[model samples]
Target: MTAAVESEAPAEVLPGLYDIDAELYHSDPIPGGSLSSSGARKLATECPAKFKYWSEHPQPVKKEFELGTAAHTLILGDGPELVVVDAEKWTTNAVKAEVAAIRAEGKTPLKPSDLKRVTEMVAALRADPDAAPFLEPGSGVAEQSAFWEDHGIWRRARFDWLRHDGQLVDYKTTKSANPSDLPKVIHDWGYHQQQEYYLDAGLALDLVDPEKPFQFVLQEKEPPYLVVVTTCDPVARGIGRHLNDRALNTFALCRASGEWPGYLEAPLTALPAWVERQYA
Candidate 1:
């Protein structure tokens, strides 16, 4: 009997430097993906000023240092094998606990519009049969981070799971029912931005040189919604450069002016808009 030759296509990939719309970062989908909506809202309200305070001052050694280090240690540990298990375990349990304590009492939890947005994601994933492949098989989470510099601005992003080749990846649970519809949805949401920002940060860190490439792993939540991967071309990071400046500037002004009360008193919606107007 003759053995049939098996041919396989190369995996999809992405470049290492770029920018992403903030929405993608906020739209993660897992059991409690939308769970944080209430907490984020409370922060916007009860301790409105705290946002500025938190943004301006460097994070305390306990949080920024201890947790981050712990996360890395867990990532490098052997038992979990996949780094994301460590990350999800850390994020869902530890991060949630810390936020709960620091959050004020008597400040009723507020519902952000993102709840509806994420629910929409869950529904779509359930409708699509192909999305199953994209769902994290309750495994395969890896830890990664990137550092970057642009026009004197500096930034860093730490994440979980990347392709074996060091290609940047952001996992997702989608809302599409049809398998074929996934690509269009991913493109429309500026899904490319997630990997781009990481790549840009990685470039700044000098982790990879020119021709640096990466990938974005899309894990769907629906049946038939198996994994979808995409590779992209490197592009100039114009908006990312600006946003980094804005975040840094917002932090600096809060510190230098000593006028932090306005942030706390203002409407929740106003903070982002004001930050943009000031930095833009």
Candidate 2:
């Protein structure tokens, strides 16, 4: 996989799409600085100070993500290689050492059981009548990175699967993919914001139509692996756009003033509405 070139100047990254490695994209190759959808969420929902710290300090890989990451690699035909550890448990020193070696080679390490689960998940996704069309081979590209300038600020997005017909698909593996639970999942995970942010990138790059909606292909990470194809409604999209604007403005201000402030020293406190109702 080819990595994106980084330079001291942000201008070096011309406004366009590039097929780059995931690691390079996550590393933020735009020299001066670039804001990603995840970073935008942090800036808008959390505090700027927290976002800054996260950007500076990349977190170590978590074991919980191994299954999902492996699923993506198998389903999308992109991302890191999935190396099976062939061990039932990771309790032994040899197994631990082997897992570390796999990671050192920039590949994901998974147990035999996890590998089987990931394979089954991919099979289920491909067999889905609705989800199959979006990810049909040669119909789209996966893990394509998009970089563009928004109001003089560098912004970037990595699309999971972008179809030639201007359809954007984001895949997510979750514990529960039931339709009834998606609204809360969308809000809790900031999927609305992510949808709009990715749409902005596609629009800026002329890869997506204004009328086309951003879609999510969510699947359960268990037997049967139920799949659902959904999109943000107009109202949710509006909220997403509003939040993205707030994040952009905050990011620009922080970049200009070099001040990433946290919350107020003494913020007003409020009890939960449910908690207060309990007293009634």
Candidate 3:
């Protein structure tokens, strides 16, 4: 709905160019939404048909997404003013009506059980030694949007939390916060690309201190609700940088040539890496 918002960047704290709230920014149409790192990664990983479907469709907000949103609000956001559910519990003749009411109000639709889990996550995070810095007053910036033209293409980032000291934190609510499980988790979600992309976006926007760290504040949804703050190392960041380069180049070529490819034209079977071990 709004064009690229250009403003004088903030001094040493974070870039302040696009000061709009999360709701309005997320509602932006077409190219404004198209060029986010998540979208780029999605396009890069998916078949052209899947990517095109997403480009044309409105995503169904799933229960997990609602829980994640609610958890973010409880832990790192403006909190429950934006969260609307019928009540702590309800048996009603009007399920659709209540949901429509929540949607109409421009709020996050969360269930009572969702809030309970979010509260649990907050407690877990608070108890974690790694969370002390983020818990400090004025330590972090929340939900700030920044947009700019990269080369000839427009791109954007909505930071979860950017510390004044220059560290960036992305809050994630997942089923597993176990250290051993994180690589696959991160790979599946393209979090390496996200961290690399977000950090670069922050640097380009002057929204963060480049020499500082980029981290994820990961908390599991299921008990015992483990939480940790961790960063991808140089190798992961390098891989991410390469992936982003290819994705961006692919996007630019697709834009110019108007070709959206799907599966490889050649026939091939896709197999898991572990399949080779089984052959052994």
Candidate 4:
């Protein structure tokens, strides 16, 4: 007899609130290749408003690295109980070493320079009266600033961790000015679609307790900059809900209309050509 495999239930997510459907239909991203704010600024002195937003907000990008670390530890594993994806063997070994060190002492698993950057950022934030609440160890809201819920999408999101009480977070890294000021950073990065998507997916999955408030972890840095923590207010959460709902609805519309390929193709088409040009 064949053994039966139990499939996991799909995670729930919140709806998007922005005009994403319209936006997607009206405007499509250049499609492929990673571009940083500096690239955008270099592309144009004025740059697109979108790129400008990114330059003003660097935390989201740093959060990507933090998520990568979490994915390495929590999701990808080996020795018969795990599957490795997206990362190479060397990267896996490095993660294993780092995880081991975390178990050995109070020292951070991330690099010393990274830790120093984070500590300095925290100090800077604490220095600012407005940023203090979010940086304080016991700041109830700060501790549980952000939470994640699983979405049964193609790739799992890294924002799965929550405080014991279910606070979601998206940690950031930057080498910027005093880390004390958080509100401004939060405002710049918090409005992006990806942030809303994370929040929405979590909300839908019911991964986060509705009773707890939601927030993001903003890390800002310049070349010589370090980490600083920032948070969003109710308005930010509301914006997340709106944007996520729109993305979801757009996805649904694409699926039903059988026009999904266009969206997928948009990136596929541009990326290969850009890569080929690099070689040529």
Candidate 5:
């Protein structure tokens, strides 16, 4: 006899709020979207109008963004994830139809060149001792999406892979994969904040190991497709937490007051700090 299964009650996420649901996450329309790590970063730095525009307007994934995503899909996903076409024969009517069909079916379309580069990058990743295990069999969760409350606000993070050993690995495509220049890159991209934020979600939901850290596999976009494994230093992660706090506070204030301001009224009378420091 089969044992009867008991169904558990659904989670108590608030109305108009949905925690991470991976199947529906990518398909949904973006205009008027909820806050996420990327949004938080942009809100913290960008002019309010730009931030508001991002929040209020529908955002189609940019071509570059799609390419990066396709790379990730190819590297990590098990099933057929995308529809790629040969760039050389891409102008043909049948190829055009295939491309349009991919769009119609809501799948990502890629050129042959893009796939080639991704394959090269994948090879680079597999050759690296650190990143190879990250993509190994039973390498833990792939493309897991999560949502949790941050400062009473709903925020989401879509993790590329969260390993059993407590390491969260995210693939990044960059113009340069030089370890020497990564600090500036990390700071500029708010990637450290992403580490904190993603960890926050994972820890809160008991989804990932709390002790281990995040590891980023940085791959170059060009010919060689060099790969490097790196992590945010503790000090940087601390700074990232602070940055996230500031962003959260700013967002809360703006939402409560419904005022999204633009750039400063103070006009620039002289060159900025970097220029002055250089001349000093």
Candidate 6:
């Protein structure tokens, strides 16, 4: 069940699926505030002070992210329209002004060459037998936002793709999509926690089945644009769930007390075991 965003803001943000714009969703217009997967991850991995600060002040878009965003627009057939700038370099004042204006209108501006690369990357992704079926244009909805309550906290998640056949798919652009390197990538970026959090949203709203594992479609940014399809195993999912719970509780406490604390001060720390073993 999907609800369309009204031209005027609703008095209350009811829990359900929504077909809303990315800008509005990120703005977090949910009444009494809401916790997103990214926010939960930040609170769990870093200090709450960092999360609080960043949440209040959204970061500016980075140039590195433009390629991935363009690819998503092409592949998922959703998101902000990409405006191709016909220029070899953006050093010129005119080119920079055009790019800025395009962004001001909520459109993504890409170099002609970058747009061509993104098109090729999408082609490579479509050719993958394992990944191709999941992203078939009419097979699912793209960029759908889900909102629901969990343990007295309003939780929200935006899915990259939700298949009609009950699968949750997330697309990621990376420097390397090699399966061997993915474990560390997943650990460092908290992909496991992200998966569990997304899954939790779907499960709460009955959009996903418990038996179905969350799917990740990872693609490399460079030449060949290799794509890999994978999912979190039970152990990883367990760890993710535990961490999410901890973050949620921490967020609740901080909100109630109006205190977002930083890391422990002046604490004694030991060197990593691997470093100690090398010295020994």
Q: Candidate 4's residue-wise lDDT over 131-242, tens digit each?
A: 3443344322211111122232221222423434545544454333354545455445443434454444446545455565444444454333333433455676566556
| Candidate 2: tens digits of C-alpha lDDT, residues 1-280 | 1223232224466887888787888899897889999998888898889989999998867889888899888888998998888898999999999999998888999988998899999999999999988888787788888889988999999999888788898999888889999999898899999999999998887888667677899999989999999998889889989999999999999999999999768667879999999998
Error at 149, model 4, angstroms: 12
Please report the candidate that would top lDDT against the real structure: 6
lDDT of 5 by residue, 240-273 (tens): 9988888788777777788888887876588888
Runs of candidate 2 with Cα error greater than 4 angstroms are 1-11, 278-280
TM per candidate = 0.38, 0.93, 0.82, 0.38, 0.80, 0.93
Candidates 3 and 5 compared: the better one by TM-score is 3
Compared with the true structure, the alpha-carbon lDDT of candidate 5 equals 0.71
Cα lDDT computed for each candidate against the true fold: 0.38, 0.87, 0.71, 0.37, 0.71, 0.88
Which of the two candidates, 3 or 4, achieves a greater lDDT against the reference? Answer: 3
Candidate 6 wrong stretches, greater than 4 Å:
1-10, 267-280
lDDT (C-alpha) at residue 163 in model 5: 70
Give the lowest summed-lDDT range of ten residues in model 5. Answer: 1-10
TM-score, candidate number 1: 0.38
lDDT, model 2, position 7: 28
Better of 2 and 4 by lDDT: 2
Q: Residue 140 lDDT in model 3? A: 69
Local lDDT at 30 for model 6: 88
Looking at model 5, the pairs that clash are: none
Please identify which of the two predictions, 2 or 5, would achieve the higher lDDT against the true structure: 2
